[model samples]
Target chain A: MVDENVSFEDNLKELEEIVEKLEKGDVPLDNAIEEFKKAMDLVKACDDKLKDAQDTIAKIVNENGEIVDFDVE
Target chain B: MVEDYITVSKVTDYIIELFRSDSNLKHVLIKGELSNVKLYPSGHLYFTLKDEESQIKGVMFGAKYKLKSKPKSGTKVLIKGKIEVYKNYGNYQLYADEILKDGIGDLHRKFEELKEKLNKEGLFEQDHKKKIPKFPKRIGVVTAANGAAIRDIITTIKRRWPLCEVMLFPSLVQGERAGENIVRQIKRSENFNLDTLIVGRGGGSIEDLWAFNEEIVARAIYMCNTPVISAVGHEIDFTIADFVADLRAPTPTAAAELAVPQFKEIRNDVDQFNSRANLAINKTLNENMARLDNIVSKKLFTSPGEIYAPKEMQLDLTVNRLVHSSKSLIMKNQNRLDLAKSSSVFKNPGSIIKAKKENYLLQFSKLELLNPLNTLKRGYTLAKSEGKVISSSKDLKSGDELEVEFNDGNVNTKVI
Candidate 1:
């Protein structure tokens, strides 16, 4: 499953591998269909990740060694 | 005599004027080693210029000039200043306007020495360099809080990969204590779980950027678990931190760029992979379907009977031959049998034998009829010339000799 534990890079790598295997055209029909489904799921997961992205504000470590939000003025 | 004596204040003023009026005392250049250097909060620098035989107090107003080389206690320098007396202390000091470093300066020598030592220790080896993550979730930057370096890093990271959390560990990036301050900040960055750390500052002179060349800062960067990108100065400026860091970006912006991939590129990659997968799967499905169609279109499946229709036809012909081949032969023989059965020989055997007797009697009678004796009995006579019988009367007249023939006897007679 494509979740937080599996990084986006890993998910993408898996997706690429699945696509490569499918392109080789020797896979059994049943396994190919199953892998196709898995690949689509991975694509959707990646699309969701890209769409859900939000910019995070920068933070700073203060003189007292405390972490706080400090935007660049 | 009491009237001639002047007040101490007046005498001090007079001395101050005398020292100022002396042309030789004004605008003098002196070369000596700096000692007891002090920089006040008021931006004034005071130090002692001392030689083996003599020493003097010196002051350089900070606002007047900036020194490329920061002079410390043991630094040799040439000072251009005017000798002036302070009324409050009743002492004269060199009021410096300009201070030039006498040689390459201690900072450069120290930088070279530390660089050589660290190189020998193999801190800059390629094997020790850590790989920066292609997609970092958290990036830490250690630089001056209010400097261009921090701003550049933040802007670049935000513009390129905004998904990552950028943490700034601002520290003093110059002066004597800057090295320790930067080390502390780097150590602090470890707790934040930074995937990459950018430790640097904007461009400055050799003396201004000296903190980065410090051994403590270099070792700290080397020891940092997170991959460190050192962006100490502009492209031309190289620092010890740059050598020890996992990656060396020419500037802070470059450091941030090296830390993470561009967001747009990643998105493009995903989209490309998605389309490629789609095309591949579609092609696979199409190819498989085509193969199936080819197989299904075969006579074996579409019309199974047609597959063996010719064989079936051959079998029917064989069966017909089997039935008719013997039947026709037997029918022909039966027809022959019927022909034989319809013949008189098989229908009336006794009559055929009686007919055979009568035929023999008739043949005998005909044979008897053909006999000349029977003709003689009918009173028919035959004449012969020599041994030949004469059928014509002309041949008998011409014959010289003739024989009169009767059914029972023959007699010789003369033709007369």
Candidate 2:
């Protein structure tokens, strides 16, 4: 799997597929362990992405694309 | 063709003469509802004035009144004007020099008319609505910069879908220019390449939210290629923009909720998947281990000589059957021979042969007594001539020389 640039939903879908594949028990023993490890990493990654998020609103009319000061009603 | 025909100028002049001289057509007051109101950039009012029966084309140039906006659509108005014929179109129209807003008594009627017109044009169709993306990386918000509408949308989107970047295109929410400005901002947001857009304002009176009802704003919302969500003033006030937009959220806060999903919910889903993966792998391992344990427990497979023991038993059974059958066959044949030898035929063979030999000797002796050589020995005198014994006297001849032996020998003789 590509490590970067995937959206949360896309990444989550892949994680779900991995879990399902592991659950079906068709994978070899070595592959099953490896798949389990990958799933753990994805869980951690998703959690981190959510925790690191911050909300920002920016104005695009200016050159810097910053928040232009306006009267806050 | 021109024998007695009236000129085009003459016909136009006669119509103008009728309009100018008519008492009611000059400086007359007419009461009706207004429709299709438009305020031009030059501050001139252009619209149609109509009652239920009919409508008249009209305009009030900017040179006359200088005050607030041109009368909003659906306003019952008393207009004083003179009917004048346009030389270009050859149609008489009212040139309203004075317009007074009697009252805006038919707002619902005006709303229904515009809605019906737009609906007939297929603006509110389901097919025209676009699906909001489940996850948006960039969202453009077309709303006033300072109000609770923008603040709520930004906060809600950030809380639920934290990765989304909000681009604000500030716009006027109410005024004569509000609808036009909203259209301008929506058009300008196209450059941002937004995944979705929310155009809304906080709660207000219907007249206060009238900018959203403007056709310019509705048509702009209809024509935008981007998916738009209209979150207007209140739950009860439904505007034309709400119908034309891809989705209608009751309030600005609700629009943010609709735009993005909850982040925590998906994390829980992933956790469930993680456990299920573990459960499946463990199940396979346990089953295989059980199968191996079962196979190892059987003594037939685990120990040596298990196969050889059965084969030895089968060999012993076959050898015993062969020996028993051969012995019984020899004994049966020997008993039959012994029984035959014990019968009377062989034991009495000598007695029977002796009796038969004695009978043979008696018959031989009788035969010897009847032989001719025996008769010579008894009493017969043999006269001999040559080798014959003469029986009759006539048989002797003079001068014969003879010798004779009766039974045992003969003597030679000659005839004389």
* DockQ leader: 1
Candidate 1, residues B180-224, lDDT tens digits: the string is: 999999998999988899999988667778899889999999999
Query: Could you report the DockQ of all the candidates, in the order they appear?
Result: 0.50, 0.34
**DockQ class, candidate 2:** acceptable
The stretch of ten residues in a row with the least summed lDDT in candidate 1 chain B is: B63-72
Candidate 1 residue pairs that clash: none
Model 2 chain B scores worst on lDDT over the 10 consecutive residues at B63-72
- lDDT by residue (B1-416, candidate 2, tens digit) is 77789977788889999888888898879888889988788877877899999999887878224423357789878888888987777888888888876644466678889999999999999998999887787888888877888888877886787778788888889878999999998998887888899998987656668899989999999888789999998788799999999999999999999998887886677678767766876887787778779988777678857968888999999999999999999999999989889875676788878888999999999999998778878765466775666777688676777676656666655555
Error of 1 at B385 (Å): 99
Candidate 1, which segments miss by more than 4 Å at Cα? B1-105, B306-416
In model 2, pairs of residues that clash are none
